[model samples]
Target: MLSEPEVAKHCAALLEHFADYCEQMDEATRGYVVRLAWELIGDQMDRPSVRRTRRGH
Candidate 1:
């Protein structure tokens, strides 16, 4: 299992890579991808660790 710091580091890297990928996509595709990403992220925010982190526990 990853610690919060490790997860944060990986998420940062992934966001940077995702941004680069979106830059190469057309507007419509980028919008779709961003929406999907947010949906997935919102879903993940329900996990225990994520909820704890969000609440600053």
Candidate 2:
């Protein structure tokens, strides 16, 4: 399992490489790609780390 710091480091690198990739794509495609990338990353980050139990036993 990766720690949060490791995830951040890899995500930073992924965004950097993604930027380079988007630059080489056609202008019409770059916008969609960037939006999709952000959506996916945002979803990943927004997910809860664990499922919570109810207050009652």
Candidate 3:
């Protein structure tokens, strides 16, 4: 399995790339992209995190 720090580094790089791509999108497209990303992230969250997200924490 990947080490935790390695995973974090890769995630950071991915976020950078995603941010750049999103910057090129129009407001509506960017909103959709963000919402889709949120849903995908929610799917991976543990129960407590999911609850906090649902509560808008």
Question: Which one wins on lDDT?
Answer: 2
Compared with the true structure, the alpha-carbon lDDT of candidate 2 equals: 0.67
Model 3, 1-57: lDDT tens digits are 224777757766766777889878899988776665565444433446455434555
Who wins the TM-score comparison? Answer: 2
Model 1: per-residue Cα lDDT over 1-57, one tens digit each: 234778768866776788988878999988776665665455443356653322555
Q: Where does candidate 2 stray beyond 4 Å?
A: 1-3, 40-57
Give each model a TM-score: 0.44, 0.47, 0.43
Candidate rank order under lDDT? 2, 1, 3
The residue-by-residue lDDT of candidate 2 on 27-48, one tens digit each, is 8788676666656566442347
What is the RMSD, in Å, between candidate 3 and the native fold over all Cα? 5.7
TM-score of 2: 0.47
Comparing candidate 2 with candidate 3, which one achieves the higher lDDT?
A: 2
